[model samples]
Target: MTTSVRGDQLARLLGRWHALPGRRRSPDYAALAAAVRGLLTDGRLALGVRLPAERELAEALAISRTTVSAAYRALRETGHLTSRRGAGSWTTLPHGHRVASSGLWAPDDDLDMIDLGVAASAAPVELVHAARAAADDLPRYLGSSGYHPIGLPELRAAVADGYTARGVPTSAEQILITSGTQQALDLVLRLSVPAGAPVLVETPTYPNALAALAARRARISTHGLDIDHGWDGEMLLGALRQTRPRMAYLIPEFHNPTGHLMPAELRERLVATAHSTGTELIVDEAFVDLPLDDPAMPPPVAVFDRHSRVTSIGGMSKPYWGGLRIGWVRASAPLVQRLAAIRVGVDMASPVLEQLVAVHLLRQSADIVAARRAQLRFRRDALVEALRDQLPEWRFRIPGGGVTLWAELDGPISSALSRAAEDVGVRLAPGPRFGLDGTLERFVRLPFTLAADDLTEAVRRLASVRHDLDHAARPTWRTPTVIA
Candidate 1:
């Protein structure tokens, strides 16, 4: 079934479409077409979704129907859109331009290139050993159907035991295993939010999480964070009290892009405020296990909530291995039951063998994470050093735990730089890829997930790309995008 995008919804997604810095103003029609193209290329607006009517979109954007008509006409000529007489216009890509790669997907053709697009590390050797051991345990379940609606019992207990050890007092009944945290979030969004419902999220969060919210067609409300500064209490409190969002998705443990860990006091306050607003917090703890600074890990976010208003979502993907594709949600048993029922209509269950492997790996989690942290610390340091040495003008804070560095460029050239870096065989995630709207142009996310040598080389290429962009840039009003 084709998803339909409404006029007002398309207007919000095409925010400030005509206000691109450093480029001369084009006709409104041309500018509108370009913004739609960017959304398609970034996978924010998935192809094949039917768009709004020209008159409806024009009214929503407060533009002339002629301009919207011209825009849609141009889009069709370029094969970015297709329309039938009765059927509305749907997003479609031209033949050659259709092969888009996202943060989760590496282009199959770009095997030799460096990918700083994804913040995932290579699987630890321990995972391989766990896989071998899991094979031995798999035969025990082969006699039965492999379909586990919620998850395998052994894995659920292991994950629940993990939370119980961490002070959350979780039971196996509260755990519902998923294919990954992405799927976990999808399930939570399904249960917790309805279309056009207010849902709060950070300004520059995990891109995939934003996409998930978009998929649910949630009315996204934003709270911002700075890389140098952490969360803004006043802004967050105001958002909660004003929007009174139905749900809020957060990454308090080790925020993606920016590695700011929300303080324990703040987490407590936020949880209380969310409860007051009747907001359910979907806490993403994907990077909670990788602590580079060796700081004491904070208790689970759910521990701070007295009302049981928090649902903690996590996976083995970030800390252990993405290939495992095993994750779970910790919530009230009734909610877990609801999630399992909802999940049954989807993929049904994660792969039995991968779940078995995750069970073994979780048992040995301490040693695996210890080794993983050592490698991350080394690579993070190397990436930081290379950036300082090669591009001193670039500003960033060394992230204590997460795998990425959110760097601020001297200008709003992040989108331009990402494209130019392709010539150097390095793929970079531009800052706006993490933004809710067309923002964060002065920043970029660099992952230290590569080896130390590759990290150094990637920065070297980035420095070259920055140097080239700096020379080619034109004089313009470079308005800084403020977080919060």
Candidate 2:
């Protein structure tokens, strides 16, 4: 019933594993154990998959048998692996692990389901009012063919004006409206990165960006973000100098999952470095307006950019409403034109009515930002307190501003716990989904976007499942079932 990973496949996986960031003084055995834990957490090493024999893996990795043996022992003691007297060791979840029926972020038909995978909430009342206003304004655009591939002139001006007000000195010509930040990213990558060209990304970055870059066949290079210290400037600069990638994707305002705001000095330095190295920096400001505590965050990276190397992507999805489907790209006029030209093969234009709604919302940015900050702060505190009270073993930093809290589990069971939580009508995203190489198995991102009561109940359910997983007898391996 155990599925054995071929020695060659394990070697290939280890090749990718070497790219994972590590501390300078950490021992090899510890790193190996952590890497294996990440693989298990990310589902690359499926539960009950028989690992290669100790000597085989040691030879594959060209490390001492003692190091491999020590790593395996560490994993066994942590409940991530189990071995029999004659049988070899097999990967496993610590007891009580159940696979989730619904895929991560997929809608569940059950009304009672608690969704913690998406860091979004219900639309604000302002959005409803704005939509109504947009309906009234729809008639003004009826005279034309309604396809504004470059976007409606008014909305583009408003977006540019918003940036100018924030000290970025943008003009309407520099902005191109898209459906959302996702589309903007796709367009940028398509237009910028050639196939197999090197593209730099932050480790534990937004998964969708990774997907977009991969779709373009980009050769991805990564720099790690420190959970406690935010980004390592020296490491980033070094990677930039060495890789000299065509593009670098960053979430500088409030990073997804981690929520660490990039310091202003670091931002300036990164812009300068990327400019010197000819790496166009794509700054995602999706969570820019959701600052829970600091209302006066530093200006966008474009503000520090003198050359036309930094491109800022903004969206209404996180701050105002995900349903709005409105976002924009801020770059040079020529670049905006280039993206719009490429966008023609896709959707010809963003919806005119939605662009109107975005304009209305941008006009009321102050009130919406204030309201969202207050609401998110309340829910964030509630979720943190509930976790502390019910599940103190889990560790997480209280994010200064952002929808989700990236918490580290005491053990490498995030994937198992995600699956089990789904069985109890709770939808959770496993940790590895955020990383490019299926690392981060010891962590999970929990959003505070849900209501306080729902957040508390979700934690309660997680606690119950953890108790079961911790106490139940070790499970026996069954025939491997391919996860659709």
Candidate 3:
């Protein structure tokens, strides 16, 4: 099946190819279909993108074409891939859930599934014991019908204390507790966003935030984070000045996906930039507590702004157990009030028992931080070592702290790699999942928070897949005909 590769067509797809990372140590044929479907859902690979012919990819990957063919056939049956007799194969947007949905098993259904998609770690032992003890005290709050929207006084004070400990002064009244960091994000979005206004966001950012803002009809304009050197301070300030956006969302400390920390100087400049443009800044600090090492991070962006343009969002999901269902917003007193008022329509109130448990956990947060920091550091180092050994072709900077590695695949193999990974029981978040228009296709985020054993296996399976692709034979028709 040799198709001529036109010079222009090859150039068009050249820089657009990306390789998704593998999360399984070994391949499983039965599980491959569902995993590939997830890649489609997660926006790692999109519809109509051409896949490398089986033999071409297999020879390039040093793997058997039979394996590649099986994976492609599996995807074709699921409507994730389309093959024409002579035009070759291309990725497709799944048409319906009947195929992919039926293929997906609940996480509980697959006892072997390892979730590298979530950034959370196992719950801290001390917090668990403390939560148990706090449950014993839950009935005391039952007298009030348990509707505590502002959160219990103890929890708010604990949160306030956390801010003070980090050099930011705050009062309990300035805090509004919510269901989780996600709820905090939603509350702030409702209170601050004016429909149709532009919001400044970083490229390769948290996807749900983008969706929430879009749902509110807020137009988003993104500034790219330099994957090679981290966030470009000059570029960010320039974007703020040019757009003068209504609001800008940031994850300054231990940023997600890229793990780039904007320097304290940049943080101050960013806040200043926002103020100069009359733009409000919303900072998500969910991953701030998961650094590989406790490097001295700058004060929260909120602390540097004398004009009060910054709103801080925090959550228990990343730092502690995600099951806590507790998160809060710290803003100016007026903003806090506004958020609280808007929150009532979403849910009358958050669960009081969870707040109580979070308060108990808060008391021991320092200990929990110490334990989590150490454990994550180990996983980070382990993953880094594995990548260095098995996939030396890829390049990445060692992130100071964070759960995932933002890696440049060094070649356009992300989509094909993702498909190949699915042939084994692995899943991934393609680089474009964090960017718009699939701009970061060559980049992939690999979480380092999985168990050491699982991390090793995932890397091994990934290496195997890569080996297969490297050795597959080339096909005559390599250039796919773009469907008009």
Candidate 4:
């Protein structure tokens, strides 16, 4: 009933495992056990995959047979592996443990789970008042057919005036409201890029965007964005020239997960390059208003857009609330009309009530942004301090103005750690979920939107799991391999 993993295949996978930077004191046998357990927990080592024979693995890893014996014993004792004399050893989950699938949005039923995946928070108090005001104003639209695909005129004008105030000089005709940014992204890709055309994306981007593009069957080209250094301008330009993709999607302002803001000069360069290369640049600014510390962030990337090649998508999900479901696209009037026409076959139009509430919320953008920033700053600082105190081995940068911190672990075990954390009621989105080809095994995105106490408790639970992995006892080699 078990599938065996070849010695060479196991060795190849194990070669990528590196010890946590500061843990030189940990014994080699214990480290090996931890690494194997991590792979099992993360689903990389499938349940019932028989491990290589003890002597074979020892020789392949250049370690002693005794050490391999000790490591395998440790794995069996921890319930990550089971062994028998004739059947060999196989991987498995620990008793009472289960894997929880993660996504960009968490399910409403996850109230008992401590969510470290989503970077969203509760709706503001102003939202309720706005909803009430919207209800009062809803009657004005009752007399009409209520099928404004281009958006309610008042809301459209307000969105345009907002962009113009920020120096983009937009008109109501240049705006098209959608259900949310995800919808805006979908409509853009469906209308502009042909099915087989190439599209560029920044690596470690929003997963839903990747999903949307993949659904369109668009050939995806990627440019890596560094957590420490922001986007590589020359590399992006090079890719633009080489691939000549029909569209390039970027999250330049208060970038999600990484929290790296694109500089004004870099934004200008990107806009110019996209124009010259005949590529439409789609900038997602969902997190633009969620600045934590810096008050002097650059203007929207659309400010540098002269040729109308750049389209900006802004949303209320992150800044105001995820439940609002209000987002807009800013592009040329003709393009907006085309997108609106395409949207007709979709939902036709976003709900009138939500749009009315969005108008009220947009009118108070500054105050809302300022309040969210202050609260987020507190949460971010608290989470950072907790990590330093409880889990110093985990390394991460202090993000300036975003809801999440892209934390790097000591080894390629993020998925495993996430699995372990789930047993203690903590849910995480592992590093690979943010990457295109499952390359970021050593990283995890931790959102700071939860309360300070919840963040502390979540880290505590994770530290406990790490401790157990480090100190679990080695099992006897003669026990029968267990399937459950």
The alpha-carbon deviation from the true structure for residue 375 of candidate 2, after best TM-score superposition, in angstroms, is 0.5
Off by over 4 Å in 3: 1-41, 44-108, 470-484
| lDDT tens digits by residue: candidate 2, 1-484 | 6579866677665554433343124567766776676566444566678899988988888889999889889888877788897899987665645455432222546689888877887888888888899999999999999999989999999999989987899899999999999999999998999999999999888877887897899999899887788799999989999999999999987798899899888899999999899999999999887889875688788888888999999888998888888889999999999999999989999999999999888889899889989999999999999999999999988999989888888776665577667667787777777777656768888989999999999999999887675443222222121110
Backbone clashes per model, in order? 0, 1, 36, 1
Alpha-carbon lDDT of model 3:
0.73
Question: What is the per-residue lDDT of model 4 for residues 189-219, given as tens digits with 9 covering 90 to 100?
Answer: 9898888889999888887788789788999
Q: Report the error of model 2 at residue 24, Å.
A: 31
- Superposed by TM-score, candidate 2 places the C-alpha of residue 158 at a distance from the truth, in angstroms, of 1.0
User: Residue 476 in candidate 1 has what lDDT?
Assistant: 16
What TM-score number comes out for model 2?
Answer: 0.80
What does the lDDT read for residue 480 in candidate 1? 18
- Put down candidate 1 lDDT per residue, 122-142, tens digits, no spaces: 899887789899999999989
* Of 1 and 3, the candidate ranking higher by TM-score: 1
Superior candidate under TM-score, 2 versus 3: 2
Residue pairs in candidate 1 whose N, alpha carbon or C atoms collide under 3 angstroms: none
By TM-score rank, best first, the candidates go: 1, 2, 3, 4
- Native-vs-model 1 lDDT? 0.83
Worst 10 residues of 4 by lDDT: 475-484
Identify the runs in model 2 with alpha carbons over 4 angstroms from their true place.
Answer: 1-7, 10-105, 471-484
**Any idea what lDDT model 4 has?**
0.80
Query: Would you estimate the TM-scores of all the predictions?
Result: 0.84, 0.80, 0.79, 0.78
